[model samples]
Structures are given as structure tokens and as C-alpha cells.
Target chain A: MRIVLIFALLFAPPLNTKLGAQQKPAPLEEVKVVATTVLLGQLVQTIGGDAVDVDVLVKAGHDPHRVLPKASMLLRLKNADALIMMGLDYEHAFLPALLEKSRNKNLQDGGNGYENVGKRIAALEVPKSLDRSQGADLHPRGNPHYDLDPENVRIMAMAVREMLQKVDPGRSAQYQLRWTEWDQAAKQEIAIWKAYLKPIAGRNLIAYHNSWPYFAAAFQFKIAGFVEPKPGLRPSPRHLAELEKTMQQADVKVLLMESWVARSEASGLVKRSGCKAIIAPLLGASKQNRSYLTSMQALIEMVGVAHGLPTIQEFKRDAKEEQ
Target chain B: MMAPALLAQQDGMSQGAERRFDPAWNPAIGVALDAFGMMVGGGDGNNEANDSITLRSMELSLSSRIDPLAWAYTSIEFGRHEGAYEVELAEAAIWADQLPHSFSLRTGRYLADFGKWNTVHMHDRPHPFAQGVRQEFIGGSLAMDGVELHHWLGIGDLPVRWSVGVGANFAGHGHSLLAAESDEDLSLGHAHGANFATTSAGDFGLPGFAWTGRVSAQHDVGDNGYFQWGASAFLTAAGLSQEHDAGATTELFELGQNTLAIDLTWHRLAATDSSSDTIGTEFFWNQRDAVDETFDRVERLQAVGLWGFYLHEFNAHIGAGVEGAWWEHADKDDGGHWLSGAEAGRQVAIFAAWKPTEVQRLRLILAMNQPDPAAAADSILAVQWSATIGSHSHSLDW
Candidate 1:
């Protein structure tokens, strides 16, 4: 009997193994994925777990506004079963040509295969009037930069899950299961970030572009002003001088600039204002050996470090010192 | 201006000459009849009526797409003052291949690429609209018979696009000529003099030739939904002229003139779920070179204009929004005593449009334009109904 048991163990389980090895209800079909950036790639993967193949055209740390299509990039767009775009004219310069070349006319306007992530989230910088000349330049249809807000990311993820369900009805239940876990984790992380930010919520900061409105609104941070008076128009010496004077009055301690803008200008402002400058990633950044989550955590950690407050490192040091 | 053609022909067609048919070919038949009535209000000196309405602009055209690459675009227009019909856009040409950068070349009687707004000729318009100072200062804003080579390039991974064109006109520009001391305004406020007559036709009287070149660049960003920012510059010059009219006195002055214009436009298109926006700001300046053998100084006209619009579209079916235009010309003060009557205006317009479908659009626009209240006083309430029967890319008129 002992010899028989050893033989059975060497081969497989007696009953459960035989049933389990027979077949999967069916081999799970590969899930179709369409993403605008690498951050979405990570998020979808974390939730999708494995049964999917995701393709993102835009890399992290790249300016979505200026992303043009290469010949190779066109081939990738053509093969995608679905397409996800930031929408709200953020990628206007490139998306039109890409769609035309892909011969994907269905994705042009109201195609079912096309998904606009901005539609699911609220926008900032919405102008009161439709006039383009009302103070340099302003977005008449709210701000399209909702991606900066962590809460909005959750909303976007939910929309993505819904779209994925439509794309793969067979794995709808599995996708929901994974979505719940990922969304709950995201909500918990957001709460932790909110609490972490509570100490310096009212701090004043200056921005390079108008990209920070959504983030400022979420955290109750006051935006002192912008480096460029108008979008796309370079700030004249006179304008920069005026901005310096305003910065002194506002007592802005931090100069927040987008990574895409030339650092020399922000450096000039930092030198003139005698303030700490932070080159923050305006979009989902893909740093070497780091994901979007880690990049965002690094940014928040830097903010705490810039304030000269108790960083997580500092806290750990203090605890050891107390010990 | 004809020198480029001769040069190109001499350059040897065997170099890279490929025989290809134009993609923009259309053989369609159309019939249109238009009648307009305008009211004149408050004229003091030599006015016929205090308030009267009359036919303003009416026209009919027979457009023919002769071949794959060539077209025969002909139109006849009737004016209110002259009360006579004349051929307006009687020309033919071909649109060549578009480059990968979205730039294309054309050899035809098309309008000279000048102002952002003037590229669309009046005869092509479904209704009559007033041209701005930049358009008015530049001759007819119409095409000179010539061949133009154009291209677009980006600025080092930025969202900026540069459009450049080099070409020559079949006829010289006439509006740049200055009036002589003997010139007088006729009863119709029309300057009947050597300047107007010679400039309208040119010294050869066959309309002299002119050399033209222009460079325009626009950088757009997500300034707003259905709105973006853009700026462009254009330059045109009447090159050396050989033919001179001995009988006409104004033709005796051979001064090559060049005009330059720069402007910004903010444009936006929105739908319920999606939106597109572009904002552009422009500055324009024109200079008249004194090719005159006489003691005339080079004159210049400088004007600044800001034009932009924001549109909130529920969908392609329905949308509403507002647009604004503000223009001011540089002050001109010479020894001459009569007021130049240079125009400046600020206009704010609210408009609503209904698109029954993708191809048909009905728009209602109401604008209050204050055009040089001191010099000329007139406010217009214009409504337009625009529609298309076919694809946009296939039509040259848009």
C-alpha cells in the first residue's frame, strides 16, 4: 500500500488532479488592450492580472500634446482591437493623422472601438465664455488635465474596466473581481495620500503651465501664478519681471514646473525668486526601475522633503533615534 | 514672375519629372441663384437716399472639372453700384500631390496666399462678407496666375508647424501705387486717376508680372476645448517690371512694392463627448517700397488684430458659442489734410448652429461690430446658411 501511494503521488493526485488536469473550461482568450500611456498599461495589467495583451503608443514622461506618429507607430495602431485616447484636444496634433493612416475610420468620431478617458472625469480651467481672447488663453470646456488628480484615476480605471468587459464578455466576471481589488487598493492609497498632505494643504506654489489646477483643487493648495502668461506664448522679460514681483508679494516658497518645459526658464525664476524649484512630471512618468505608482510616491515624497518637513526617512530616523 | 516657369522648364523635366494625375477631380453640374437687398442709412453730402434697399451681390457660376488634375472654375457676379454682370473667377489650374508633411503645390490662377481669411475668395462664398484691413490692404486677395511650391516642417519635437511657399504671380499687384496730386475722388467715392487705372491693370496694360514668396507658421496647444492658438505671417512683392505704359502717367512710376502680414487665430470645435481647440494671435505690417524715380518716400501700414472663438458643441447636430475680433490700424499722418478714414473695429458675435446631419449645417450668427464710429458708421446683421453636398477633402472651393 505504501508503494502504491508513492507511485500515485509521483504521477498526480488521485481524484482532484485528474479532474483539474483534464482541461480548463476553455483556454482563456487573450484580452485585447488599448491604452494611451504606459501608466494605463501598468494599471490595466495590475487589474487584468494576466489574460491580456496591452499596447500603449505614448511612453511615460513624454508630452502627450506633441506626440507625433511614426511609420512603425501607425502599424501598432492599426492592429489594436480598441483605441484609448486622452481626448479633450490634448493629443490633437498627432491623433488625427494617426487615425487617418491606420485606416480606422470607425475610431474617428463616435466609433464604439474608440474610448475617451476624459469623458469619465471632471475637468478644470473651464472658461466662463467661449471667447479665446479672454485672458491669454483658457479652456472653455473645463480643464483636460484631470489625470493629475489621483481620485480621477480611479474613475478612469472604472471606465476602462467597463470598456474591457465589452471587449471580452467571456472574462467579465474575472475582470470585475480584479477590478474590485485594484480599485479598493487605489481608494485606500488615495486616502493615505490625502492624510499625508493634510499638514501642508494650504501651502502656496507657482506653476509653469496651467496643468496644476486639478491637483491644486484636490489638495486645497493655492496656486500663486503661472510662469507663462498665455499658453504657448513665451513670457517676455517684462512678463517675467512682473511675475517675480508678484511672487515676492505672494511669498511663494515652491516653484512647480512641468518636466516638459525648458528647465532654464524655471531655473531663472528659482534664482530670481530665491525659491526651491520642483520639476514635476505633468503626465504619467515611466522612470527606470520604477512604475507610475512609485513615481507619484517619489513626487509626493519630494514635496515633503522640499518643505523641510518630516519625511518618511526622517520619521524612520527619529524612531531609531528615540530607540 | 514668369521667370520661375522659364527656369523650371530650363532645369530639365527629366530630373525627377513623374507624370501623375491629380486626385481632386470632380465632374458635377450645379445651378445657383442669389439676390441681396441692402439698406443705406444717414449719408450727408452727396447721398442719393437716406434709407433705401437694393440688390447687393448676386452670382452664378459654371464649374467644370476638366480632367483628373485640372479644373475650369468660372463664375459671373453682379454688383449693385455698377448694376452689370461680369466674369469674376474665370481661371483654370491643377492641384499637385500633397507631401507627407501635409503641404501641397498648386499651379493655377488661385488666389495669392496672403491673409489667413482671404484664401477663400468672394465668389466662392455662399454670402457676402466684409474683408478685414489686412485683406483690403493686400490687392484683390485673389490669386495671381502662377505656380507655388509649399512645405511644412516641425520645430524640434514641438507642436509647432511651419508652412513655407515660394512662387511668382502672372500679373503685378496694383493697389500699392500712390495717388498723384491731380487725382480726385469721383461722385461715387471712386478714385478715378492714373494711380487706380494703372495699378488695376499694370503698365504693360496686360497686367505686369510679379514675384511672390511667403512663410507662415502656427503652433497650437490645448488652449481650450474646441479652441487652439495659432499665428502666421505672409509676404508678397511685385518684382522688376519691364513693360511700361507710355500713355498712362501713373504707369511711368516703376516702384516694386511688397506687403507683409502676420496674425493669430483661436479656433475650436466641440461635440458632446469630444472637443478640439486652437488659439492663434497675429500681428501684421505692410511696407510700400518707393521704386519711384521721383522723390516719394517708402510708406508702411501697421495693423494689429486679435481674433478667436469658443464653441461648445453638444454633438455634430447642435452647437452654440461666441467669437470676438478686435482690429486697430497704425496712425497715418502725412502733409495731406483729408482724413485717411483708417478703420478700427471691435466685434463680439454669438452664434448657434444646427447640423441636421454630417453634411448639412444651418448657422445663425448675430454680431455687433463697431467699425470706426468717427469715420464710417454702419452695423450689419448677417445670417448665413451653409451646407455641403459631398466630401470636404474632394472640394477645392472650401
Candidate 2:
């Protein structure tokens, strides 16, 4: 009996020492936060600064829509003080199972430590009615790709700051200061990006999926149509023909697509419609695109150049020449 | 700024209100339907009856948080059995989630965590049919009315989980799991008693309760692969007892059955594409003991089953797998002579599945089974269609 008791105690889960023994107050520990996507992780890291440790579940270049949390990911979540996610069913495919298995009450939905950045932000392209025939990729709450827009990124950063402050009250001031700096810098960057996109502000564009609606809305570009007939369904030949007619009628000259999507159909569409197809990274697809600022800047430069607008660098150089 | 307003209208939310739970909060409700068409050859007396299309099972599942400290899950299955529509309560359990020392407790009827496959639901199984030893020994599954306690821990960053449970259920001849038979009718084959044993405090009887325990450890094999190994054991009284006398010596004997199993699984998904692969194997050893009419004589019946399968996903929509299983049963009589029979068998099956969406699946399976002492083997071809609506399939910690 003594051996059995000793064996169980040795193999028990790591308990919270402070909670177990209510004697002296334990020192504040670093807040460990787990984010569902690379973009969200970047936002959390930027705003939390040195006050928190951030772990990302879905790595760069992977589609957040199809991720299955691995055992390692679950381990990261088990010790998390808070969970930050782009919730409008964006991570629904994997998050529920992971949370259920993690058995971490702090990170479960409705818990004090759960932070859904997209919950408070307004959503785009929400379906009016539930329809599975729309190709099973429909987001009932709204489009969860809002992180593609710089403005939404700012909102998400603020949400992360709020979550950090709640989880680690002792570092609230530190988090607030860092968040203010990031917010001002992000606003300035958005202004600059808007200036770079001025020449093609109202230009009509085509994209391979509905991934760009929030982005187009933020940049003041008009989306003429999508290559896919619906959200996740592939474009049939007839649908492509109809899209081509729409593009020709609107005189659309740029077709935007993500790097992960197959280029065959987008290339065919560009050839038939006489448009330039610009493939852009949706998230941090590479190390160079790891930061939210760098990824957003790349997206703006790609779209601006594809639409025949001068690149930001060229525009600045030309302005200097004029001065 | 204008984008937020546009999206607010797009999502039909008020200017300041966010998506939050209201007073009428309810859990997600889901239903799954499974139907199959089978063609079989060389099954002794049931060949004609088995070669037909059947609606195998329709399951309704409900899951919700009962309170801040508890969660509940219930699944009810309705299907056609013996040309009659039958309804069975598959699982109805409530779990206490917030316990000290990373422990949790669950109570009510649930599939006992006996082996790798017993805890899984039928619709999610790789093969359409249960393995032979599972059907003969445990009656396919052991869903007992019981309580289970689970604990989770990590050893130097490697996750390990274990559980212990006890339950009271009818266990004996002709008492198949999930079948329509009543508990009172499940007797110990006239050797014990006319009525099955009960676990109620007032009627507490010997050999009435079942006990089970399991332990598992998991580790990451590589950047993209995970390996898990588990061991489980189950014990129960078969309720079969007898009294024997030899001259001036008298003895009372009872039947007891025990099973031990070990399983290993490796799963990996390609980092670049949707392709994934899983390989798993399980070995089981079961023994049943009974004393003979001769006061001092004892008999032992033992069975060993080994099963393995490999599943691979070629892409997002298609998957294929092959599974094989073998079972050997040995019985030793009072004379100490070992006897083996047709109960020992081997089966091999190959199947391919097409999943058009995450909630729908279609599968084609071909299987061959050879039973010991049988003149010829049996072959089967079957196609299965399964779909779920309203919620994701209920999954346990894999």
C-alpha cells in the first residue's frame, strides 16, 4: 500500500503549488497564452511584449481552416493561462476537440481566460440563412478572415492586450504601454498604405475565393466577382465563363489569389480575361512575412503593383524627385 | 472604421452588442445515419438473410454543460434488428469536470474503456463488422452501468493518462451488447441462477460487479508523427457457479473471467498536404475459469486475439485501409485435456472511403473470414453510407 501510494504521488500531474498550499503568496508567473493562428500569435506577441509568452498552434503557411491540433499543441495549451483565437467558427474544426482534451478550464470558451478576438469585431459576408448546399464551407457567423485587414489586426491587438491585462494584472501597465505604441504605429501604417492604394481606390478586382472581401472593404476596392461560384466550391467551366463575362463587363484587370490555392484555374482566368493574377500570402507564409506589419505591407504592394499602381517605394522616390 | 459598420450590418449585429450567450443557452444537437448493403457467400444458415440492404443504425446525440462543474453527453441509437425496429440507449453519462489533482469522474451508462476499439462507436470503426473474438467473448462491447474516474499527468513533458472504473451489468451467455435483450433474461446458463446478479446495496451479491482499468502514454515520434501505447484490463464474474461433493468433501465454485490487452498506435500527417497515415495494433488475452462437478477439479478456457490495421489518406476526399485479425481459443476440461474448436478464426478486410465533406462518408469493403474446423471460408462485399447533421461526431481522446 505504501509503494502504491508513492507511485501515484510521483506520477501525478503538476499541481499549482500556490493553490495546493495556502501559505505564502506565490510570485507572479509569466502569463502563457496560446493563439490559434500565426497572425494572431504575432499580434499577441507584439502587444504583450515581454509580459507574456505566446505559443502558436497553426504554424505559418498552414491553412487554419484545416488544422488538427497535435499532441504537442495540446501540451502547449495545457499550461496556457489564456487562449486567444479568431473565433467565428474559424478554428471550429479543431479548437473544440483540443480544448476538450486539454481539460484546461481557463482556456475553455466562456471562461475568464478565453479571449476571442473576432467576437467583438464586426464580421463580413455572414450568410443570411443556413445552407449546406452552398458547398459546406460557409461560415454561419461571418467570414473569419478578418485578420487579413490591417484595421482588424489593430482590433485584434487591442483584444490581446485586454486578455493579457486580465490574466496578469501585475503587468497591466506594461501591456497598456506596449499596446499604445503598437496602436499608433499600426494607425500610421494604415494611413500610409491607404495613400499607396489611392490610385486604384475604386478599381474593380477579381479574386479566386471570398477571402478578400474584408480586405477589399478596408482598401476601398470593389470585388467584381469570385472565380469560385460559392465560398469553397470549385469553379465549373460555366461559372468561369460567367465570371469572365462579368470581369470583361467591369473591365477588371487584376485577379488576386492566395499562394496556397492552385494557380491553374486562376492562370486560365487571367489569360481569358486579360487580367494580371497576383498571388499573395494570406498569412505569414515565410519567415520574412512573419510579422503582421510585414505581411500587410507585402499584401498592399502586391495588389498595388498588380493593379498598375506605382509601388510604395517608387511612389515615394517619385515624390522625392518632384520635391 | 467604415468597414466595421459595414460588417456589423453584414453580420446582423447591433452597433454595440457582441456575440454572447443569452439566457436560453442550449447545447448542440446532432443526428447520424448509417446504412449499408451487403452481399455475402458461404455463411452457414444466415447467408440469404444477410444479403440485403439494411438501415444499420440511426443515432441521436446530445451534449451540453449541465452546470459550471459538470458536462453531460447522451447518445441513443435506433436500428432494425431481427426484422424489428429496436431502440437502445447507447450512452447517457454526466462528467464532473472540475476535480482536484487533475482528476475527473463520470457516471451512468457508458462504453467501458476496456481496449482500443471497445470505446469507439460503431459508425466510426474502420471495419463494418466487429472482430470475431470481440463478438464471442465480450459480446461486441461492454457498455456497463457504472462510474469511471480518470486522471491525467505528464512525466517529463510526455503526456500520460490513466483511468479506473467499476460497473454492474448482465454478463453471460446470449447477452450481446447494444442488443434488445432485457437484463433480467441474461442468466448464467442454468449453472448459476435464473436471475442475473444485481449491484444494488440491499441485493449486493457476489460476482455481480465488473471492474476495469487502463493506462496510456503518448509521445511525439517526429515533427509530424505521434505514437501512443496503452494497456487495459477488465474483470467480471460470469455468474456461473456450481456445488459439487466427493465422498465427505463438498465444494462451491464460481466462474470468473478476466481480460488483458495492449495496443500501440502511430499517426502522422504530411506537413505539405492533406495526406495522413495511421497504423495500430492490439493484442488481447482472456481467460475464463470454472470448477468442475468433481470437488477438486478446475477448468480453464482461454483466448488470444491479435489485430492490426493500416489506414492512409491519399488526399482530402479519399482514404483506404486494410485490417486483419486472428483469434485462438483453448479450453481445458476437468480431465486436463485441451480442446480447440471453430470459435478460433481469422479475418482479413480491405476498405476504401470517400468523404465528400467532413460530415459525410461512403465506403466500400471486401472481407474474408476463415473459421477453424470449417470446410470453407466466408466472403463478403459491402457498401456503407454514413452522414451526420447538426454537430460533429462525438470523439474521445484518441
Candidate 3:
């Protein structure tokens, strides 16, 4: 009898109690939280400390805008006590469908548990109007890319901390403490990155999309133009011709093409303009990249290379003359 | 991850059922409501009054995962058609799961895989509606009834999916309410057949059924993204002649003819978690071989187009971008009934969309569309306020 029991225990299934004991239950004190991006997910994980379970929907290196919400995301939203999202239509295509199909009131807009993190952060590229016909596709309210800058991230962390504490009042102090630590870390990193980018400061660059306003502001990079004539619209021959003329007039060299955009088109523009186009990580490190810090480091290095600065050296170096 | 988890749970149930005879059917149902409106008044003349308002198009679908390898889905839709109540076949099809060697079969009246726009309808499509190019070229107003066989091949980093299909019976035949008759109106191209087609004056030989064959391929390129290309050939032998009792000598005449068309699109979604840039272009060439010289003649259509969009997150809350497009179609020779002309135009739009929650978006867009003389012929300045209630992936795909 004893032998049979031992065999059954060994081969039948993992005992729930044993599994529980080996893998400590994420402490009840920490509330589980979910985010749609790795950067935001990591940021939440840091500030919430042991009190939050941060889940990221889009893995690293993927475009959030194009993400097709999977059926599994419905379950995630349903089970989540509160839902946080980037406010702009960045996740427009898939997120609304996921929320409606999930039927999770907690994640829906206007619900007590729902929050738009962008509302708490500063925005860029505010157009005078929402009209898209004139120049290129423009964001009317402003640029939706506030998270690319570290300072804006601080604002988001505070919002997350406030919301978590509001939902789980008992853990208010813990949330506050973690928020302090995260803010300090973020500020420190921002200062470091700024100092690192000081040499390449004030350089004019062209971006394929209007994604780097905050990053550009922090690093002092001026935007010469974008490759796309408008948002969601492909570049037309006439548009490209006009842009090439503008590039020639502007003397822009570095093309800040995101890893998500097709490189062939950008490379073609580069070939035509004699500019160096480099693929920069649009979203910081993902599961593949391990952590947000590493992703940021990678981004800095990529930007440095584009600027013709020393490659990955611990010490900062001045930008080289235009190659 | 969810599929596996569900499968494991099912295994437990199956084990429990092994001791008893169990008969069962699992069913799934979904309902959706869409609001739509059309502004028709401001055209050439006030003759066409502007009738616009938010109206509903409701649909319901029933589905069953018949077994581990088979499934079926059907839906019924009710809505207004040209200002009248209508009920139509929204969807009806049975799909075979992964058969031996990654093969599958589907039959019944379903969408014919044409361009990226044909696969998904207006409500389910990523954008607010089909682009003008799709509406004009692929006839977004069209659907097919038939069978489809598809297969997927895994080749290293790229997964290629292909499909072959045949369909029949097209709806909606409208002609220029403004244009008059000419020799160009005779045996027309399939695209224009819905609008007008010539008939034999005297009783003679009649045409047979129209048949179409399609081929499509999609290739995923590592982390960069994926691209898809497809083409279709439709044929209706010379016997494809119809008769009209409009004071003519013959009851029917032989109208032997052939029509052919092709299209392609590429989608490179943003990397794992960021908003990626997407660019897509399509070229369509259509031909209608001349039937009996006695039969009136119509010309072919050649169209080429390109559309691109860019999205970047300012932060989790705010992001903005733009999209622009251009399309041009070549004219054909209609045998003396009328004149054929080519039309080319462009559109540009800039938009800002706000997502207060993951599932809700309040977007304001400004757009300008130029028209072709053969088409609408009037430029449009459009300001749109669109709020989406459900999740529809915005990735560029059919």
C-alpha cells in the first residue's frame, strides 16, 4: 500500500500543497496589476514592489498599435481587479474589441477601476486642429507618445501608485514607499541618460513616425521631418519627392527609424538623401530583452551610434564630425 | 496558452465520460450592433438629398467546435439596404481543422479571399470603413458563394499560408444614373456587369455559368513582419449570353468572354509591444476577352494603388499619426455603346485618437479626397468623429 501511494504521488500529478509551498503565493498584501507594454509593466513592478503583479500584454519589440488582442487577453481583463492602459488610440485597433468581448466592467472606460495613464502624463505634438488633409497625418490633441521620455514615466508611476492604493487601501503606505523608490530611480536614470546624450545634443534628426517627442526633448534632438506624409497613410511618390527636397534643404543626416517601421522604405530614403538610417528600439526591452533598464541602455547605445559617438563605452565621448 | 489550458480541462472531462455514454453539443453565440450613416446630399445637385443619421446594423452568429478537428459557423444579419429593411446571409461555412499535413477545407457561401479588404467586413475591419480604392476596385460591395481549400507550409522563420477557391452569384448591379447608352454597353467586364450588360437581339445560343478560381499566399518575415500576394481568374465561356424582351429580333445571343484580375498586400506590424509602421500597395489588372464580334464590346480595367500609415505612442495615454493614399484605374473600350475613361486620384488624412480605456477610442480626423471624372468626380473635404466600441485590430490585413 505504501509503495503504491508513493508511486501515485510521484507520477500522478503535482500535489497542490507541495506546489503552493515551493512557489510562495504572491503575497496577499501585493495586489496584482497588468499593463500592455513591457516598459510600463516593469515600471509598475518596480513601484508596486512585492505588492503588485504587473502583466504586460504586448511583449518587447512589438508594435502596440498593431497588436491584435488575443482571446486570452479577455480572461486577463476579466480576472484583473483594476485595469490600466495607455490613453491614446495607440492600442486602438484591438483593445476596444478585447474589452467589449471580455465584458469586464472594471476595464471599461468610466468604470471606477479604469484609468487612462496618459491623462496623468504630459503629451506632445498637439495640433491646432484634428484635420489631416493639409500637411501630413497629425495628432490633434497632441503627440500620443509621452511615455518615451523618462520624466513622463514618473508621472505615470505616481498615477499607478495612487490608483493601486485607492483600490487596496490597506497597502497605501507600501504603494507610496515603492513609488518614491521608483521615482528616485527613474530621475537618476534620466539624469544619467541626459548627461550621456549631452555630446550629441541639439542635433537635428528625422523620424519615420512621431513617436519620440519626449525622448527628443530629453536628449535635445530636433525633428527635421517624418518620412510618412501622414499617419496611417503610405508615402506617395509626390509626397516622397517633396520630403526628399526638404531633406536636401535641411541637411538632415541621422534618420531615427523605429525598429517597427519597414527599413527598406527608410533605407531607400537614406539612399536618396545620403543619410544614415538606423533601427532604434521603439519600445524598451521586452521578455526577449529581459528588463527595461537593459532596453533603455540598448536604445541609448543605438542613438549614440547613430550620432557617431563612442560605442557602448562606460565613459561618455563627444559626437564625431558628420560622417 | 489558453488553448492548451482548455484542452487539458477537456481531457479531464473526457476521462470522466469514458465510463458513461455521453451525447452533447457545445454552442457559442455572439451579437454586435453597429451604427452607420451616409451623407448623400452635397453632390452635383441637390437632386440627391442629404439623408444622414446614426443607424444600427445588428448581427448574430452561431458557432460550434464540432470536434477536435472540425468546426462550423453561421450568422444572420438584419439591416437597411438602400433605405429598406433587409435580412441577408451574413455568414455560413464549415471549416475543417488541421487535417493531415496542415490542410483544410471550407465550403458554402462565404467571402472569396481577394484583397485584404474582402476578408473582413466594414464593422470587423481595422479602419472605420473600406478605403475608397477597395470600394472602387475590388468592389467592397461584393461577396462570393462557393468552396475553398487552403494549406499552410512552415518554412524556417517564415510561415506561408495559401488558399484556392471558387465562387458564384454576385449582388448589386448599378449603372451611371447619369450616363446614356452606347455600344460600350455590350458584353461588359464582370466588374461592370452588375451595372449594365448587352443582350442578343435575336433568339440564338445562350451563355453558360460563370466560374472563378483564386490563389493567395502569405509569408511572415522573421520579426520585421509579413507580406501577402494573391490573384484570381474568372471565366464564363462564349455561351455566356442573356436575352431581354426589349423589342429585339433575337431572344438570346452567345456572349463568350473571359475576365481576369490580380492583387497583393504586405503588413509589418510593430515589433512585439510597440506601435509599428505599416505600408501596403496593390495593383489590379482586369481583362474581358472579346466575345462574338456581333456582341457589343467593353474594355478592361487596370488599377494601381498604395496606402501607408504610422503610429507612435507619446506615452501610454497619448499618440498621434497620419495616413495618405493614391489610386488610379485605366479605361477600357466599350463597343460603341459608350465611352470609357481612366480616373486617378489621391487622399490624405491626419488624425488624433484618444483611448481613455483600452476598449474605447474617441478619434477626430480631417481628410481630403480628390475624385476621378469616371468615378464620383467631385473632391471631398471630410471631418470625421469616430468612436469605436469594440476591439478590431488595426493591423493592415484582409
Number of the predicted model whose DockQ against the real structure is largest:
2
What is candidate 1's lDDT per residue for A98-185, written digit by digit as tens?
6654544435457655778877766776666664233323445677778778888787777777766666666777878988987888
lDDT of 1 by residue, B287-372 (tens): 44333233333334344444455566553345676665455532332322222333554445566766443334455666544444
How far does residue A266 in candidate 1 sit from its true spot (Å)? 1.6
Off by over 4 Å in 2: A1-29, A71-74, A100-105, A108-112, A203-209, A224-285, B1-27, B42-49, B170-206, B221-225, B237-254, B290-298, B330-343, B371-373, B393-396
**Tens-digit lDDT track for model 2 on B183-236?**
111111111111122221212364646788999888876545689899998786
Chain A fold similarity by TM-score, each prediction: 0.81, 0.86, 0.78
Report the candidate with higher TM-score, 2 versus 3: 2
Docking class of 2: incorrect
Ranking by DockQ: 2, 3, 1
Number of clashing pairs per prediction, in order: 28, 0, 81
Model 1 stretches with alpha carbons more than 4 Å out? A1-32, A132-138, A282-289, A313-323, B1-398
DockQ of each: 0.02, 0.16, 0.09
What is the clash count of model 2?
A: 0
On lDDT, the candidate that comes out on top is: 2
